[model samples]
Target: MSALAIILVGLLLCLAGALSVRLAVLAAGFGVAWTLAVAFDADTGTTLLISLGGAVLAFVLTLLTARLLFFVGGLCVGAVIGAKLFVLVQGGGADLLLLLVMVPAVALTSGLLARRFERPFLVWATAFGGAALVLSGVGRLWADAAGELWRPGTTAGVVVVIVVWVVLAAVGYSVQRRRRD
Candidate 1:
């Protein structure tokens, strides 16, 4: 991916992670709608309409039920993690079934956790989601430097990226926790 694209993706991830509960409805709804529209090869206007409708529906659902919001937020966070993991594992020749399994497993686990832990869950989920995005962006940048898109670079480089991701996530988590307190 281009540097600009990487940056934009990173920023988006950070935003989603930081405000997951607030944005979950719109993100999940529009994301699913867009995916369906593209899968069906819908026209531009149709896609827009579908996405907007989905967003509105999601907003109403989430606004009406706090529990649903938590579940959806967790699902969205898990989906992000699942996608990142899928890409990493796919590079190792993982099967389609594995990808499918990973997504629901992560989503279910996260949803349950969110239900059980409430605010703490949101904080951690957002932190981890943001970290994953940051890691992916850095990885892409490294690959670009090496004339590739997703190539895993040296072990040292990988370690550095992971360390940075963890630190940033910890900071985010702390900040969110403090805000809640």
Candidate 2:
């Protein structure tokens, strides 16, 4: 049920994120709330209820301070990219210190760019984020049904996931680009 909900939300973000920034912001809040709630070992119902409350608070705050939130989102996206680059470059000896130093620099740059190019950046951000959610939700559903992990189990699973993410993001980006005013 949760997996299904995730897929639906992911699709909404992917296909219509740029058309509705408010919804996208709400979804981001909800997604973050859900992730944080799940990290605690609590009753599922109670956790979900609390998560929903948190999401609501986040949505309201984001609505009040949209520009600040977009800058934060840019920082997050840049930090992720920077960390990934660090890992890939360092490989077996990925240094935490270097990553810590690198992430902030990249994040700062990205935040500035996001502020300058809000709509286009949001379109890209939503596309990438949504694609990730769709893939993760599908993988979770598949694992639950089959009692196995698909991405890690397959020999080329990682590559396939990356390829799929890129394709899905591209499709979403293209569609949203056309649709956005």
Candidate 3:
């Protein structure tokens, strides 16, 4: 039940995150709380209370530290860009020294870019993050319910999941971009 709730909340984020920053934060909190609640095997009442608590926490935190969150989000975006760049560089048989140089450089560049374009950055960030969250919740729920065999129950399941995530992310990105404009 809680797992399903997480999935629903994640879906909301994936589809409409950029419509409202507060909604994105609250949805993230709702998904996280429900995901945790699934482990507790609690009654519906307790789960609802926990989810509400999570939302309240999200509200308070966002109210208190919106700017900090934006900065941190920029840093996080930088980290992801750096990681991807690292992999691309590694493909050329790059060495440790190059990695040490490249990652921070890319990260710094990305952070600067994010700082200059906060809304667009948030849209992309929320889209991908929401898709990932949805995938996680679905995977967890599927595994717990089916025992052993995951999502699609076959190797093709992996491909399917990846494709689905990409599509979701893309759609979310488009929707958020439109909304932002």
Candidate 4:
């Protein structure tokens, strides 16, 4: 398959995986709804309508599968990664590797953390997002240390990510502590 086909398939599976997580339903919903905006394979109106329909279905499915959300999330993440693997084998692109590795890894780790620390999925999600931001910033720094290390955008992103994660972690700890009350 072509690279565009591969990316499209990957994105679809990612939408499915994201929809599997109740907490991520909003993002997934919007993402699916924006399909037309990104893909030009069909009439804009028709594509947008289909996207909206899919978003509604995904949102309902996510809510109904809330109890099994993590397992579903893992499955979806795995599927997306698998799709990426297929793309890579087809000589898709270097970015496929990042998606394959990051998606499943983040899903597994986040699922585990959320399970171990229930009632704080929001904080955990925030921390995970922050960690990702920090990692991305670090990668940029590695790529061009001289240009971005002290750049306002880079510094701000890194600092916000770290501070957010730290604050979330502290909040998680506090919530756990107070639960004994």
CA shift at 30, candidate 3, in angstroms? 19
Model 4 Cα lDDT, one tens digit per residue, 49-113: 77777678787886676556654444443343333233323332447566667667756765564
Better of 3 and 4 by lDDT: 3
TM-score top scorer: 1
RMSD of each: 8.2, 9.9, 10.2, 12.4
> Could you tell me how far off, in angstroms, the CA of residue 41 lies in candidate 1 after the best superposition?
38
TM-scores of all candidate predictions against the true structure: 0.61, 0.55, 0.47, 0.34
Give lDDT per model, in order. 0.69, 0.70, 0.67, 0.46
Task: Output the TM-score of candidate 4.
Answer: 0.34
lDDT (Cα, tens digit) per residue for candidate 3, span 24-64: 78898988898788788978989888988898898899978
Question: Judged by lDDT relative to the true structure, which candidate is superior, 1 or 2?
Answer: 2
From the highest TM-score down, the ranking of the candidates is 1, 2, 3, 4
Candidate 2 achieves a global lDDT of 0.70
Clashes of each: 0, 0, 0, 0
lDDT by residue (1-181, candidate 2, tens digit) is 9978987977877777656667666677777877888888758897788778877987788768878867876776566545433433443555788887887887787777777787688788667667766776787787866312223444355556567778998998988988864
Give the worst 10-residue stretch by lDDT in candidate 2: 146-155
Model 1 lDDT per residue over 54-147, tens place: 8888878876887766777788887876776566555556578988999888888888887778666867876777667766665666665632
Candidate 3 clashes between residue pairs 3 or more apart in a chain or in different chains:
none
